[model samples]
Target chain A: MKLVISIAGDNLQSPFDARFGRAAAFCLVDSDTGAWTAHANPALEAAGGAGVQAAQFVAGLGARAVVSGAYGPKAYASLSAAGIAMHLAPGNAPRTAADVLAQFQAGALNQAQAATQDGRH
Target chain B: MRIVVASGKGGTGKTTVATSLALVGGESVRCLDCDVEAPNAALFLHPVLDRRQEVGIPLPRVDTALCTHCGKCAEVCQYHAIAVLGQTTLVFPELCHGCGSCTRLCPEAAITEHLHVTGVLEGGLTADGLEFARGLLQVGEPMAVPVIRELKRWPPLRRPALEIWDAPPGASCPVVETLRGADFALLVTEPTPFGLHDLKQVVGIARALEIPAGVVVNRDGIGDQGVDAYCADQGLPILLRIPMERRIAEGLARGRSLLETAPDYRPAFQALLAAIQDRVNTEYAP
Candidate 1:
């Protein structure tokens, strides 16, 4: 299974970003192989529907699960519809993508039931 | 001639300037209050706004029975107002820009459009015989450009001596809609840092849109001389200056226009109109 974590920098050690759609970069890790790759988020430049665009991009990447601080309604709808699960990053700011991914692997992270916040236009 | 009284910063007396200019510009003048979000020119002008109409956008509604889960509707929506997920398609009316791209491109023809009312356009004649119109956007509505667009188009003007467009506060989409195709932009601003900062932004917008703009410095004595210096540097002529006064604010609280608070300034506003007309003719005669 592949898991994606929203991050600020290119590496797994990059700081975790609270923003799902406007995150600077997304770090994807293959749980079985432990191989990781970072994909820069293109939705940051989207004038509107940034959440929808980001969700579509992540679904296209074939990630089974996504880790982020929060998800907007639109993003949550798209991801859940594509059968991709969402896990909320534990704790507050200053956390790293790798830190959150470790918690995910340890079964310590909480899975989201629905959208965490209001959607922006 | 159309003169849009705009301000990058709010509460800089845009409505004050626009209303007064309309009063002085004679019965041949019309006032279009384009500040849809918080339109208040009616409070001062006391226009008998008997003529009213609903303003709305064409929002798409998807019929799930016919929807093939093709996701084409989601892909075509630029505003992300629609989403096709698995067997379901959702429509976010607030996010919809009413561009009709999704409705037109739905391959199965499952999408239909309906008018979603967002605002109201009110107009009639002011007590002073000036044709007055304003757009009032519904509370919490994100889009104001559509209402502003309708205000300019409805009950069309008859090439009045001047059309005073009272624009909203900011250099955003609605402001652009208000300034579009105007003969002049009468930019109102206070003499403060915030005023100067936003003024610079709107000036760029005006110049980019190729609209000839001038400044009306309301509350002229309150802030530093930055506005004067910047206007001079930009070669944007200072057409009028309304000094900071307590009586003006007092009068405004009672919903009095600048011309009503101090009718002596009537000549000043008249001169302002003449100056704008002369500049428009001399500089942009077609």
Candidate 2:
């Protein structure tokens, strides 16, 4: 399964970014092989609807799950409709993207059923 | 002649100057408050609304039966208002600008348009024989351009009347829509840095639209002369300078026309109109 994590830098060791749509970069990890690739988030500077576009980008990448601090309403709707699971990362303290993936592997994260914030409509 | 009163920064007395202009112009002028998001000119004009009409935008409605999940609508929507997920298509009406691009480009011809109420346009007259109109944008609606467009289209009194538009702040699309085709744009600004910054932006808009514009510096004595210097350098005329006065603020707070409360300010507004007319005539001469 492929998992995508929003991160602040262009590598797996980078700190996990809480924002899903406006994240600086996305780390795509193959769970079975542990192979990871970093891609810049094109929707980061979108004038509007960044969340929806980011969700679409992730879904297009065939990501099975996304790890982030929170998901906006539009992102949540798009991701949920694409059958992609959303997991919440530790927000109070800084965590690396790799740390988030490790926590998810250890079953330390919670799956989000609804959006955490109201996105601009 | 159509003269639009606009400000780069919010709360810089656009309404105060606009209402005072309309008041001083008397029955010869018609006022349209295009600040649809928060129409406050009515508070001072107190026009008795005799006509009201709901304004709406045409949003796309997808016909699922004919839609092949081709994602054409979603692909054509620049605002991400439509999202096509597998066999399902989701439409966010609030984000839609009603451009009809999606409906026109849909391959399956499965998209149709339906009117979504964005606001209301009202027309009436004040007790003093001032014809007034304003647009009230629906709360939570992101779009204001359509409402302003409708307000502009609202017919004024049959006789020739000087149309004065109380424009919304900023150089956004709404302001552009308000200033479009206007004969003159009266930019209202404060003498502060923020005010000067926004003034330059709105002035750029007016210049881009090729509309002659002048400035009205409200609360002139409170801040530095940076705005005046900037306007002078740009060769933009400073039509009026309304000094900072607590009494003017108090009277406005009470929803009283500055022309009525201060009386002395009436001549200033009148001269402001004359200056605007002079600039418009020289620039637009045949």
Candidate 3:
């Protein structure tokens, strides 16, 4: 099944967008195989408003669960309203994609109840 | 005529140049600060806004009572905005773009849209008679484009007055929204490698949008000379250069404009304004 996963963590806020605001990291994962693709929040992308498209892209990639460091109430509410499963993965290290998936498969990692604070943690 | 001062990189003096030019242009011009997320232009212009209005976005609201959890809304949502876990229906408003696709696609018609305030737009006049508009996005609010869009919903200019815009940094949505109607864009930059890199990124966007643009190098003495070389290679004119000055930094820290503190630089701004006017006149002449 297709999914749109909101993501957060250290790697998401890397110095990539120093000139612009940092984008939340999101992942699109497959339900059957647990494969995933990563994306920067399109909303925080150049010229803004890329969030919708990014979310759609994640959904297109067949993400079932949105794994992120945190989700503010508004973001949480909006994503929840949209039918996406919101999961908070707070303080997760920037590991290889496999490790993240491993955590997901083992049920050791679940969506955080909330998105982390907006700036540098 | 409208000129948008923008930089793909932040802290490159976009606001400094914009406010200085507005001050030098004197009473006939207006300024709009479209950097809704972090609007610092007001610090320099010191505009006294007489009016303020809330900016809003539409989000889909589901009527749980009227509907069976059919999963149709979930199916229609490209962003996974709606999920039916058993009988419970969940909505995540931040991820929702208010596209109204789910409401229309829902077979049960259980979905409706509601307006959610994202920010506020403020308008007023600076001491020198320049009309000013600014967008202040609500803190922690993820949506900033709506507020920036609201700031641009002004009555069309009835006369030939310069509308200089202070655009937000980054080549993102807010910058695009602010630059929508600009006759020309004054791209500000520093001389750093990172600055040159982002300048290229934004330059591509400007080219794609078909907007005629020029460059203004701030802190002219710092960084490498690549930014200048790149501008020359692109055949884009370097309109003006502001030499690195300690006083300018001090003035900015104290909430004052560079032009206000250094009246001697008025002539430089005037010359810059004249060059821009020439560009606009040549391009838009009847």
Candidate 1 CA-lDDT value: 0.88
lDDT against the true structure, per candidate, is: 0.88, 0.89, 0.72
Candidate 1 Cα misplacement greater than 4 A, ranges? A10-15, A28-37, A91-99, B157-159, B284-286
- Off-target runs (Cα >4 Å) in candidate 3 are A1-121, B154-160
TM-score to native of every candidate shown: 0.89, 0.91, 0.72
Q: Model 2 clash tally?
A: 0
Question: Which one wins on TM-score?
Answer: 2
lDDT tens readout by residue for model 1, A14-116: 9998889889989999977878999999788988888877887888787999999899988898888778899998447598887887788899888899999
DockQ winner between 1 and 2, please give it: 2
Question: Which tens-of-lDDT digit does each residue in B158-199 have in candidate 3?
Answer: 342788889999998888888887889999999889889989
Error of 1 at B122 (Å): 1.7
Worst 10 residues of 3 chain B by lDDT: B153-162
What are the chain A TM-scores of the candidates, in order? 0.95, 0.96, 0.56
- Interface RMS deviation of candidate 1: 1.8
Pick the DockQ winner: 2
Residue pairs that clash (backbone atoms under 3 angstroms), model 2: none
The fnat score for candidate 3 comes to 0.03
Native-to-model Cα distance after best TM-score fit, residue A44 in candidate 3, in Å: 19
TM-score of chain A of 2: 0.96
Q: Relative to the unseen true structure, what is the C-alpha lDDT of residue B206 in candidate 1, on a scale of 0 to 100?
A: 91
